[model samples]
Target: MTGAPRIALITGATQGLGLALAEGLAQRLAPDDTVYLTGRDLDRVNHAVESLPGGGARVRGELLDVADPHAAGRLAGRLAARHGGVDVVFGNAVMRVGPDDDPREIVTEYAEVNNFGTTRLLRAFAPLLRDGGRLVVVASSLGTLHYLAPILHDRFDGATSLDEVDAQVAAWRDAVADGSARGGPWPGFVNIPSKIGQVAAVRAFARERRGHDLAHGVLVAAVCPGMMNTPTSAEWWDVRGAPGPAEAAVPLLDLALGPVDPLHYGRLVRNGKVLPWSPYRDDSA
Candidate 1:
């Protein structure tokens, strides 16, 4: 891996969109560039690496459970020591809880894996990024600030700090615990809040990167694939006729492989376009 042209780390690459992105990257990989693919299961991770486009010879697999922050830090440390650093870090792993589950359990699971776990990876891997690096977060269209409850919209819109974001997340967890989240606008929507928190995290990362000299030239942004047909949403995709993982990977590939545009920094992108956050753009119905 020494003297590689470029290095990239992609999590949750065992299946679905993560696998698609890995394949896409592999198809266009420069001879010296290397892409690290990670997943919870070692067998699955190795299989994914082998199955990637162009034989995936350049892809390396690692075991990673995003929910384990300590392990994530260790992985980051290893990457730092091995390659000296990386140029891109993609946060693609996610977990969701349905409305039928206990409210507290649903909120807790989603917050832990999606929100807190993602935060941990971002924080741990950020210092390992070389100058002019990029961080691409796989977010969802439904996670936009526009889809948040009115009160939450106000709070998140005004959140200028990670502490504020954590406070708001804590409040939401409390509401779920006490049953107040049941009839609320985003009631039982496990992925919504988690995704929203991811978007907010992108903003926070971009803001904080500017203050740290080690993190200079690093750009943070999130992307939504526009309702792709994957294992998790087979029924919805069956009826909606949405594109499959291979096709949906195009826009995300553009974000993952292209040069960073200053205007798009810290923004949410969909269909290869930057999506503005406005209540008027709310189409969650």
Candidate 2:
């Protein structure tokens, strides 16, 4: 609040990993630091902030539904005006519908909430980060393991420029809308490609940021929190050997708060360690 001890923003903070990360960050914040917890429901956001251990005086709540680009843009403007800029931004909001939903619907919703939502947040908040600040997105390992289309996968894996990645995501979105983004192993499982798209975005952002001559430095990357056991992930927890949200939040907080390292830029991480971007598949069922 006084000097720049660092300010953090986390979306989807009403529950699950987002709330857990808020709690962890609150515990680690200096007296001058602040962390904003956000969600679609204002009451739930306030409750989450109040529920933190000792009711973290430095933690506050706000209404933020990353699904809405206009809302995201407005929030970014407000934060910039109030705090000058933020030190860290965590694009953590995501949506996973019933496992039996139609593939088309799932693809559309996931793209809206998981992929495009993150892009909106980044575009809005990336400039607000202090030169040496960090931007982390809560991504998934499923992204690396799954492919929406083999051709798209090749382009994503071998992208020579960020524009190429952006174009590919656009193409995939168009395909999804046209009912051509089907027949993949992750059909009706939108979380996979959604996260994969996020990973690519991370890479693109990192490259674009590093290429520019800026004041300090900005490290942007995504972290796979593993398969967290929460309401959204209820269907696969038992079979995936998922950990509790609190347990999963540790690595995410670590990455968000850790010092900047060049190697970490554009990498997909788990438990504070960088994970190789590979397309290894698990065909067993």
Considering every candidate listed, which one attains the maximal TM-score? 1
Which regions of candidate 1 deviate over 4 angstroms? 1-4, 53-57, 98-103, 183-186, 210-217, 236-240, 280-285
Clashing pairs in 1: none
Query: lDDT of all the models against the reference?
Result: 0.75, 0.75
The lowest-lDDT stretch of 10 consecutive residues in candidate 1 is 276-285
- Candidate 1 lDDT, tens digit per residue, 178-282? 788787765466677778888887776667665552236666778888887665686334635788888988888777667666656777888767777656553
Looking at model 2, report the run of 10 residues with the lowest lDDT sum: 276-285
Candidate 2: where is the Cα deviation over 4 Å?
1-3, 55-57, 145-149, 158-167, 183-188, 211-217, 237-241, 279-285
What tens-digit string does per-residue lDDT give for candidate 2 at 71-136? 889998998889898887888898766767765656666677887788888888888888667788
RMSD of each: 3.7, 4.3
